[model samples]
Target: MANKLSQLDQVFAALADPTRRAIVMRLCAGEASVGELADPFAMALPSFMKHIHVLETSGLVQSEKSGRVRTCRLSPDALLGAEDWFQQQRAIWEARLDRFEAYVMKLKKEKEQAAAKRPSRTARKKGS
Candidate 1:
């Protein structure tokens, strides 16, 4: 469906950034406060927050504000769609490659059989 495709697009687009990817990786271990998430990067908090915004928009992350602190967590389901898409592509390519290999092998066998049936130059010369 169009909605699924749109979500896939958003997830891929958001993960295209290394910063955002790193954030997701960190969140995989457990949820972290905004400050905790921002600590590892050298960029300003405001700039770092832009990455979080993108992640949130992609549905790859969710955050809750408690008092003045915002904590973020990874949404594993968001990644499932992308994973399914990749698996489908892998299966299709693998099957196509298998068919191609079979075709090549068949051609090779035919050529070998044809060569075996032909007479050698030396044999033809002796006959002449």
Candidate 2:
């Protein structure tokens, strides 16, 4: 559906940035405050916040603020659409490759059969 594809597009787009991807990776272990997440990067808080914003917009991350601290966590559901798309593509390619392999094997067998039916050069020379 269009909605699914749109979500997939957003997820992929968000993940396209290394910073955003790293943020997601860090969240995988557990949720962390915005300051903790930004510690590993060399950029300023505002710059890092932009990456967080993109992830939040893409639905790949969820953040909540309590007091002065903002904590972010990964939203696993956002990735499901992308995962399903990849699985579908893998299945289709696997099927096509299997068919191609079968066709190649059939051709090889037919070639061998034709070769077996032909007379050898040695046989022709002996006949002559």
Candidate 3:
């Protein structure tokens, strides 16, 4: 569990940067060279490299240097921790909603029971 949370932290931290997020999204298509990744952004090569470095440090992406070019690929497994956390959050919310629904139904039943036990409005008006 600790390991999972750590991974989640890293994933979230890495994705928090817009440039890093864009790099991840691009890698989703397949692998891309650092030069190719930088082409779409207006930032200088050195500045863009910093974003790639963050993604690499977070374990969200891995890069290989071949010849003079560095190619990066998305690491899908790194997202597992984040997905698990989201699933747990969703489950908790669903359970709370279900409990609320049951409580409402119980209250409705109690209301109906009380109405049945009470005298009719017409009978009360006649007596008054």
Top candidate when judged by TM-score against the true structure: 2
Give the TM-scores of the predictions, in the order they appear.
0.92, 0.96, 0.88
Task: In candidate 3, list every pair of residues with a backbone clash.
Answer: none
**Positional deviation of residue 46's Cα in model 2 after best superposition, in angstroms:** 1.0
Clash counts per candidate, in order, are 0, 0, 0
lDDT of 1: 0.97
Residue 77, model 1: lDDT of 96
Instruction: State in Å the error of residue 39, model 3.
Output: 1.7
Residue pairs clashing in model 2 are: none
lDDT of 1 by residue, 1-128 (tens): 99999999999999999999999999999999989999999999999999999999999999999999999999999999999999999999999999999999999999999998999889999999
**TM-score ranking from best to worst?**
2, 1, 3
For each candidate, what is the lDDT? 0.97, 0.96, 0.91
Weakest ten-residue segment in model 2 by summed lDDT: 1-10
**Residue-wise C-alpha lDDT for candidate 3, range 37-127, written one tens digit per residue:** 9998999998888888889888999999999989999999989878888999999999999999999999999999999999999999999
- What TM-score, to 2 decimals, does candidate 3 have? 0.88
Say which candidate scores most in lDDT.
1
Give the alpha carbon lDDT tens digit for every residue of 3-111 in model 2: 8788889999999999999999999999999999999999999999999999999999999999999999999999989889999999999999999999999999999
* Clash pairs detected, candidate 1: none
Ranking by lDDT: 1, 2, 3
